[model samples]
Target: MSDTHAIAFVRNEMLPQAEPPVTQRGLVKWLRENMFSTIPNTIMTLLSLYVIYVLLASVVPWLFNGVWSGDSIRDCRAALDGATGGCFAVIRERWPQLLFGSYPSNLLIRPTMAFFLLLLAAAPVLFSELPRRLLWFTALYPFLAYWLIWGGSIWVPLFTIATILLSWLVFRALESRSFFGAIVAALIVFVVVSIVLGGPVVALLDSIATIRLQPVESRSIGGFLLNFILGTTCLSLSLPLGIALALGRKSDLPFIKGLCVIIIEFVRGVPLITLLFVASVMLGFFLPGGVDFDLIIRVIIMITLFASAYIAEAIRGGLAALPKGQYEAADALGLDYWQAMRLIILPQALKISIPSIVNIALGLFKDTTLVSIISMADILGMTRQRIMNTSEWFGVYWELLGFAALLFFIVCYSISQYSQYLERKLATDHR
Candidate 1:
């Protein structure tokens, strides 16, 4: 070989080979890298493992070998071998009653339609890439769904659709002047065209048909659907009320703060069930005799009040976590107390509060079953109602409790997961 070539080859050989990246090896590598990355992390890892093992031990068999089979309660018990699985048959047989409640047998079609419509509405919300127009579909949705589910006709549909459409148009108008003009023109044309096309004739027929279909009383609705409503209504009503209370507590005015403090502490001090007891028992007597309210609505009010207290405490912690700079900036902009909180402090505070608020919401959702004590026919209440007349205690208990647990688990898990996503999303400084 030539001396120049040899020298070049030697120079290349003299340069060191880059070492390969470190292999992630065994348990120690995992432990060092993950479990004990920090002292707190190590403790959490250990705790998580313990919880996972405990859950697996209780859940695996019930999930795989149990819960899925059979018609009679006896068959379900037999399927569990020595261990008990969930009794799914009770849920299966009573599914319709659970869904529609005392919705007249002939009126089942309406609720079933409403159920399908709900799925339709939810589909777009879950998909991030869904078109804005899909929301317009949703806005017009509640009106149609309510009319079908509730005892009504075209009047309800027309009323609901108009409300939703108006809301959407208003929102759109706020966003764009062109859209505002277009919507106004379109609405006028729609009214004129409907009148010319004999739209009222169809509306009359639809209303007459529904009236002939009879009506289901609100009291009859129970089971899983009722639980959903109870949880949703309570959580929805409570959190907003709680936000107001938290803000009130933090207000500069002594009277507002003191009143908020008193309400929150008093509610927090009592068991939720006791509050519910007062709501169901005493609230009615306080009201004038002629004005009757639904039991569901009253229970909802109690739950909202109870949850608001806890929520206020959670939000207060969040508000406290914010930097002083945010407040100063908000105030310097000449914002009022409400404006400062709404525009500057609350957005940040609410982000910090996602996890705790989720926890409270979960607790409230689960606590809704206690309404059974007040003879409110939520899911647990109906399940108990079914079992009281049955010969099968073991099968029924395992079934109902397991079913309820699964439902609760799904809801809480969903909320926790969504809150985690929200926490991450809100933490971003996209604005």
Candidate 2:
């Protein structure tokens, strides 16, 4: 018993790495686990492969035989000798029109430059790793973009910028006294400044208007440029407005909640096409006879309103999904309503709502093609009217339409990918 009592405990060193079993590694393992795991899965995989083969058999030859250079559809047809091949010549010849619509060729550089600058302006906002100072340029971008695309006297944006700065300064100076007072003071300062400067600014602008780029009319805006303008402007405008609407709908005050409810319901109830129709036709009756609203501006207003309504509902769902404890915690911390909402509620709510918001944005971007119904020449409109309708390119549908689809897909896909990145960046659960 004494000898047996001194039993030794066994110890083992860390094991060396070993190759995984052949059936549990690499492409073979993946295929077995995911594609051929069962009888039904194998059948589906084989069927899918056959479908892909059929699609490639048809599309590959059509793509490879595509006529990239030809004067007209007739030239393409003659080259192909009755074989099924895409007449992509229409896209090659009419690319400029498809991009800028009727925008003056000599002035194309303005929009082109603005487009690149948009990427710059968006960089910091999209990627937090970028220096925060870049947001200054982001703030200036709308005005810069307006000047670049619409081509107006520089003084107009300058005056607008000055007014904003003045209002902000006023608000900051008075904020310590009272928030509502500061807001009122800011508004008063803005209105008074506008009244005092508006006349002189207009006169000065008139004197130097000749120095600016030749003003492009809204009617001249078409092609994908029009879609970009509408999508970007409406998307930007809708977000803040949607946030305000969402908050208003959730407010304790009955009147605010009721008003937001009515607006959201009314806008959501109507078809977007109906709203476009109203913007194109019926909206004029409501405006003063002397007031001339630009068609693009009118469309923007309608689209923004429509998108904001849907976005409000999405945000409301986010707010509803929030745990009651979050609200109680904010309250327990002695945070004010706006403070709680801004710092705690909104960050979490918006994070949850990102996917929905991105979906709305994608829908809004694609819906911009519907501007064609109002006789605006967005990408689809340009393809249908300016390209395909031409005698030389008639019946070259697949090529032009395919190009439009590809363009939309690229933009939408980029937005989708960015949204995913944003979700990961904002993730708090650390998954």
Candidate 3:
């Protein structure tokens, strides 16, 4: 151990940093780890790339060579001159009908306005960071949407709002005394007010106030607009009803639990198509004589019920998954059933159920296409009835169907993305 050993241990100098290997840094590293790390992964990646290339090769040419300025399929074919190309003129010509069905051309502004307003109305409900006051608009949106789309006297929706407010007031007055009693009394008040005030009282108010637009019947509603209406209305209606059913099914009372069980089981057992058939054909027979139920309304009711059953099961799953300690925590807090549920249970349960609920909602939105079997002209229905049947675009299936698919994909993808966002936002485990 001489001076040489001492110098070896003590002497030091900084070595210049060396760059990482090309395979271990930047885009190359990412590609290696994600796409080519294993032999199977590399093979799969190459196959996927090939498939994508093949798809783009075929699609890009067709898209680029599409006939956008043709009067008919024949004209489109002529324009293509025997080359493979898309007859997109069908979409161009029937764009309005595909979007709005038989909605009056001049009155398109109404639905357009309602559509944009819908975004505004839903903003508060969907994203809770918004001011709570915006919920008032969300509550009023249904009536306003109905008035705008249906072009009815303003007094109808106004009176409808009044009826709900008054009934709710009655409920509040009784709520402190008895919950069940409050609900029953409030329902009675609602029916009485609807019958007494909705007809003559609305008529009287309309005559004096007199705000009206040209009426648009339910029959006139078709295309994507019809699908949007059905999807939004049914989803909105089903969520609360589903929550109630889930809670009812879990109740201590046998009757409530049994009733909810029956509803959920029966609905789940039946095919949605069968339910749609009942709505289209059989439902009218159950109604009172001389009562004219709008076909759309009947369909909405059936769809909502169908969606509610599934949603209830989803929420029930969420509820069942909750820890017993959560319930105990609520009890420890001296909270009663409703108080515990509202304050401590439902939010967590709903967060857990979001994925399931969104899945159901997506399926429901797509199922709206089945309305065509009963002659409602949603986007697919419009393509079938108005475009496919016509001589001008009789053979144009891909373009019209593709357009519909694109719209559906956009909407469904957006919903999926939002659900993912919400899951991440509400995630406590990550925190």
Models 1 onward score TM values of 0.69, 0.90, 0.95
Which pairs clash in the backbone of model 1? 87-399
Whole-model alpha-carbon lDDT for candidate 1: 0.73
TM-score of 1: 0.69
lDDT string for model 1 (352-401, tens) is 88888989988888888897788877777776765535675434666566
User: Taking the tens digit of each residue's C-alpha lDDT, what string does model 2 give over 301-369?
Assistant: 999999999999999999999999999999999998878999999988888899999999999999999
Task: List the candidate 1 regions with Cα displacement exceeding 4 Å.
Answer: 1-24, 27-71, 75-88, 97-148, 153-214, 392-395, 428-431
lDDT for model 3 comes to: 0.92
TM-score-best of 1 and 2: 2
- Error in Å for residue 402 of model 3: 0.9
Clashes, model 2: 0
RMSD of each: 8.5, 4.4, 2.2
Instruction: Give the candidate number with the greatest lDDT.
Output: 3
Best by TM-score: 3
Ranking the candidates on TM-score from highest down gives 3, 2, 1
Clash number for every model? 1, 0, 0
